[model samples]
Every structure is written in structure tokens, then in C-alpha cells.
Target: MTTTTSGPPAAVRSVSPRATVRLLGAWHTTGPAYAALADALRSAVLAGSLPVLTRLPSERELARALGVSRATTSAAYARLRDLGFATSRVGSGTVAALPRDASRHEVAAPPPAGDAPASDTPSADPTTPAADDTIDMSQATPSASRALHGAYTRALEALPAYLDGGGYAHLGVEPLRAAVAARYTARGVPTDPDQILVTTGAQQAIALLATTLVARTEHVVVESPTYVHALEAMRRTGARVVGVPVGDVEAIESVVRRTGARFVYLVPDFHNPTGRSLSADERRALADLVARHDVTVVGDETLTDVDLVGAGVPAPVVGDGTDPRLVAVGSASKSFWGGLRVGWVRADPQLVRRLAHTRQVLDVATPVLEQLAVTDLLEHRAAILPDRLAALRAQRDDLVDLLHERLPAWDVPRPDGGLCLWVGVGRPVGRALAAAAVTEGLRVSPGPLFTPDGSGQDRVRLTYTRPAGQYEPVVDRLRRAWERVGGR
Candidate 1:
């Protein structure tokens, strides 16, 4: 009964008839057809079985799927709209929503500081647990590395050199850009400083790319369950955002060929949520595919350096960023600290120039000190990674083992690298569990937050960024929440 509706802009996600019918079990109670359908839909939304913001099937589609009269569906939809459980848009069709009076505060108030999804940048307010006992599993980030202080201190000592200038580093400081370019070159992708344009963070780099490259009505492709904020950035560009399954190169090419999409975004190395890294063959295939299609492929390597296993990572997907179509974006957040707020685009110099120009309207420059700090981190990256990777690996293993022992029904796969574990809880109760978790002094992201389409209802992403000792409590809270949501 999980919903399969895609998210905004393109509005392509819709609940399949089969899913809708399954959700409406014994919906035809002792009541009118329309009332029964409306009640059932409402109950599903309230129960979190049918997540808010997903598109429901059309009246005709639902009628055919459920073997009901079209009039019954039409009336049911009308009732849903009237009850504020759904909204019908001109092009977007019926989207699931919540009425103001839905009493969702059971999951809303006393907002958890870590309730926000994974991001490398710091929030205006410092993040803290929702309560004294709350275990926040919402964000997939570790505390700042100890080496960050030294980097910032060095940056401070170096700050006077730039104070004499106008300080408008629209293209970022030279040293940091060169450092980023050097890091790529070390990884077997030869890059130049001119080809790198630094931004406030990786999120800004994405926003800048979307603004510069994605034209209105042009198509953009992302993995089905992608980084949510990246999806939001693409949708904001007014582009038709479509999704292919993660690591599905053929599916990506097919969608591009069919839709004439101009941009394809990927997290090829240590992808967030699923933590799947592309093999060397897959990377080569994607590089060739983008070249053949003459479409721009944005490879987000924000999590690239977070290799938990000593096994070396593959080279950059763009293969030196010589192709104007292959853009590689990276960040200092995962390796050093999110507070530094530094990211960059390694692209063709022409695209870098264009992104820099586009970035002015949104944010003119990254902070000078942050850029300097990140440069220091990059220069000393070899010294910084071992401990970070060790901690992350230990946490990942502990969490996986704990989940297997405590919630045996949940499928917890061990990924070689990455900060989060995308788990299958063996039930379509993710949203319900998240809501219940809040009451159990836990904050978590439901699987729906990771995807444009609502197909991952039986899934949830658990971050292993916290200490190994903290995981037992996290699993305990999750177990309590799972049971509350009817999971065995």
C-alpha cells in the first residue's frame, strides 16, 4: 500500500492503482462508495501509510485500478479536496496534503535541532538534541574534526594578506582553488585552478549549476532516491526533473534520449542514503554516455573522500573535467567540518565562468576565512582522513550489527563507505515510525524524504555518524518507535 508518487515541478510521480487498492483494504465499509473511499484515503494519510505531498492516482486511473465506478472516485476526490487532504493543481493533478486541523503536532512541536536532512553547512541556530534524552538520527554528519582548529588558526594568520585587497573573491581565492585542483590531480584527474569556482557550500554549487545550465522546461535527470536538497535545487530552476533508478546507466541514457534532458546529476562515489559507489566500468560508461549524448552530467563527489574501507576510490567521473559536459562538484564538509562552508565546481573553465557569473545574483562569494581553512585541510587531507574513516567505519559496523540484533526484520546492509545506512524495515511504516520516534525522544528522517517518487515507504536511512556507544540507544529508540508503528 505504499505510495509511488513523484515530487514537484514535473509532477510525474503517481500512486499506482495496485498500490491504491492495497491501501484501501476493505474500504467499502457500510457506507456510501464516495464516503468510504474518502474515509479510507483520509485514514491512510493520517496513519502515514500514504505520505503527504505525493500525488494520488487520477479518478479514472483509480477507478480502473480499484475496479470502481469513475463517479465514486470523482466524488471521493472532491471530498478529499474539501477536507483539505488533497489538492488538485492544473498540471500537477491531485497531491496528498494535510488539513490544518490534522493534529500532526504529535510529530511537529519541540522540533529536533537535527531534524533537518544532511547538509555540510551549519544552520543559523546551533544544532542540539530535541530534548535532553533525544537521539537525533536525522542528519548524516559527524562533529568537526580536531584538525579544523589548526586550519582556521592558520587561515587567521594568513588573513592579513587578503585584507589589503577589495576582498570580492567572486571566483574564490587563488590558493584554495589551486588546492582543490591539486586534490583532483592527485586523484588522477588533472584540473586547473581556473576551472574551479568555489561556493558557500556544495548546496550553493548545485544551486548555481541549476541556475546557469537548466533552462525553463528543459529536462534534468537525477537518481530516483537522491539527495533531497539537490532535487529541490533542480526543481527550483523550473526544469522538468525526472528520476532514474540509482546507478542505472541504461535507464539514465534511455530517459535522456526520450526526454532530451540537458543535465544528468549523480552521486557516483559513496552515494548518500544507499551508500552505493559506482564501479570503474560504470563510471566509464557514464562518462562515455554523457559524451555521446552531448548532455552535461554533474557528478556530486561531496562524499567522495569518506571512504571507510582503506580500498582506494575510483578516479573522478569527469576524467579531468576537460569535457564541458562533465562537471564535478565537491565539498569540504564531509572531510573536515560543515561549519567551514566551502565547496567548489571542477568544470570546463567556460562553465566555471558561467557559474561564477550566475552565482553573483544569489551569493557573491564564499567567506575568505572558510576558503583558506579548507585549503589548509586539503593540503593536510592525508593526515585528517584516517581517524575520520576509522570512526565512521566503527560506527557503521556497530549500527548494522545492533539493528540486526534488535530489529531482526530490518534489512541493514553493510556498505564499504558512506555515513548512512539505507535500511529496509520490511514494512511500509517509515513515515509512521518517524512520527512515533519523535514521541520516543528520537528524531529521524522517513524514507520518503530521500526520493522524488514515494516508492521507498518500507525504507529508512540511519546515519552512523554518531559515536559507536550512542548507537545502542539509537537502536533502542528505533525499536520502540518501530513497535509503535506496528512493525514486528
Candidate 2:
């Protein structure tokens, strides 16, 4: 894996057959091999164990791995595709997904506010103990601000003037771009409209950058337990992803040095799942490292707007002029809503021009109305910020306190701003807990889902994005799941 050749290496995604067999542990065997296999695999996908968009092992490979006929593996995949749980693209083989959505092309909407889709929140808990009402603690997208309606209403008043045109602006409507740029300026980054290129959402923005920048076998740095979809985006680049502990400057710089990595991805503001912000000192040290190594840092500031506990998140790490290679990705998803599907990348004008061409292929342009709505939302953000902050803090505190009571063994952190808590369950039973969570009618993400190499088996990310009342039941269900998995 270390050796690098002249041109780009042949791009392919491969999963160990043994890993598949392990994921399918104790699968239902009463029926024919294919049917039982499909059902068991479906269970894993729904349980948040096997991520959506995971490449299924080859039929022959899986057949050998599971000691079944190749036809059984083939039939299972066919069934998955038929059930809409998988898809086959020309280059990508049969890929795992949830049943409802079939498009492997579009960025599935920020994994249901937090829970990665396909690997979903609606999926069953493995504990087999059903709650009165299913609670999805996987993804915690904030409910849209009360200001959204008025903003959009105002946007409509402003819409028709632009409606006179074909409604296709490759780089997004100028007003929205200006509004987003202004946002950066307010944040101390002093961004210009030309520096911002809006996309349907952060997912597409990430894909655009990955497609434009990453090459086969190139080393890409990621936080060990970061957003799952971001990890997937980097993997799509066909790069070797190196995971470093959050806030560990030395570890990150060492990888960049060793691998000669040019790109590094980070979520410095109220980091996803963990909800921790980088200290000013840490950010400065990291910025210096990227500047020295000449690495282009891609920072996800999607959750930057939602500062609940006031971690006093520092300025954008790859600040505008200090490191020209830095690209900032922000979203309307966390602060406002994922349904808005508005996100932007702040980069150099020349790069933005190149990305616009790359982005048009992903989605010709973000929907006109949504861009207006986002622009409107930003204009009214000050009116909405305080309440949103209050709601998030209340939920975060409640979730942290409850876990301490019910799952006392888990070392759940008190995240100041982000939507979720990355809980250390004190045992390496995250997979089993995730599987059991399905039966408990609670959707939760296991530790491996957040790991670059899928090794964090003792951790689970719990989002406080659900209703406050739901936390009690979530705790109850998690306790049941823990007990079911021998967590006594």
C-alpha cells in the first residue's frame, strides 16, 4: 500500500471477505442460503453496523469467505438491489444502502441529520426490546429555525426578479454568495463572494473537492472518529486515509510529513459527535503545520454556527490569506435544517471556477428557491441564534446527565456546542450494542462507523438532536441493549 507509481493507480474498493462473515454473525439460517444471507445483511445495514455505500465483497470472494456457493452470494446481491438496499454503478460494484433510496449518485442528505442514511436511524435496534415509540439518536439535525418561514417568505418576494432568468447560475445566485461571503467576514475571515461556491449541501461540496483533488494511494488525513460520510468522501478519492486523534497536532503533522499528504480534512468547530472545539493554540499550531508542509486543509464548519456551550471556537483554521491552500466548507444543515440542502465552499477564485465546472456535473445548480431561503436565513440569523443555542445546550446537558445515570459505565463527554456526544462505553461491544439497539427500536451509530480504518469498537456516538423527552427512553433502551450484549 505504501509504494507509489508514476501515474494514478487503478482505483478499486475492496473489503476483506472475513469482515463480511463477521458482520453476518449468527445470521438467520433457517431459509435458503441466499434469502437468509440477504436478511442477515439487511439487518446489519439497518442496525447502523454496515454503512450505506459500502462495497459488498465479490460473489466468489464472499462465497469463499462464508463457505457458501458463489450463486448464493450473487443471488443475495441481486436481492439487495431489487429491494433497493443496494445499487450497481459502472465503476462501483454492488454497494450497500437502505431500501427507500436508490440513487448512488447524489449525496444522501447528511445521513438523516446525523445518522448516516442506509446505515439509518429508522432501522431497528438489536436488543429486540421495542420501545413504545422508536427513538432515533443517530443523527441530530436541528429543527428549522422559527425564522425560516419568514425568511423564505421574504425570499419569495425577492424570487420573481431572479425568476425572469433561466434560474441557472453555476456558482449559485450572487446574492446568496454575497450573503455567505458576508458570513465569513463576520466570522473574522473576511471572505469575498468570488471565494464562495455554493452546492446543494456539504456532501456534494466534499465530493466535488475529492473528485478534483484526491488521487489513488495519496495519503489523506482524517480525525480518527469523525463524520462517517466525510470518511466515505475521502475514500472515494481512492486515497489512503490516515486517522489522527482529535486535537493531536503532532500525530497529524507526522502523517502529513511521512505520507507527503497534500490534503487534510478536519471539523474544528464543535466537531461532529464529539462536540469539542479546537483551542486557539491548537488551531494556530495546526495552521502552522499545514503552511509548513504545504498541505491543503479542508475544514468542515457546517456546525460552526451552532455554538451552544460557547467553546469560543477559534477563527477558521485555514484562514483566508495565511494558508491559501485551505478550503472552508460550511452548511445550513446544522444551524437551520438539512432539508434546506444549502452548503458552500470558500476557496480561491480560480479554484472556485474549476470547482464550478466539477460541481455542475454533481447537480447543475442548487435549487434557486433554497438558495434564496438560505440567503434569507442568514440575514435573520441573529434573531434565531440565541434560541437555537438554548435548545441545543438544554438537550446536550440532559443527554450527558442521563447517560451518567443509566449507562453509568460510559464515559460520555460534555460537548459544549456540537449536536452529539461521543460516548466511550468502557467496553469493546459497540457493534453488538448497535445490533442490539435495532431490537430496542433505537437507531444509534457504533464506533467503527466513525473510524477511518473501522477500529473504534468501544465507542458509540449519541446525538442529542432528538426531542428532550426522548432522551429518557433512549437511555432506557440503551441500557437494555447494553444488558442484552452482556454489559453486566
User: lDDT: which candidate is best?
Assistant: 1
lDDT of 1 at 316: 89
Report lDDT per candidate: 0.79, 0.76
Clashing pairs in 1: 6-13
Q: For candidate 1, lDDT tens digit of each residue in 339-420?
A: 8889999988888899888888876899998899999999999998898889889899999999989988777899878788
Q: For all candidates, what are the clash counts?
A: 1, 13
Lowest lDDT block of 10, candidate 1: 116-125
Per-prediction TM-score: 0.76, 0.74
Off by over 4 Å in 1: 1-130
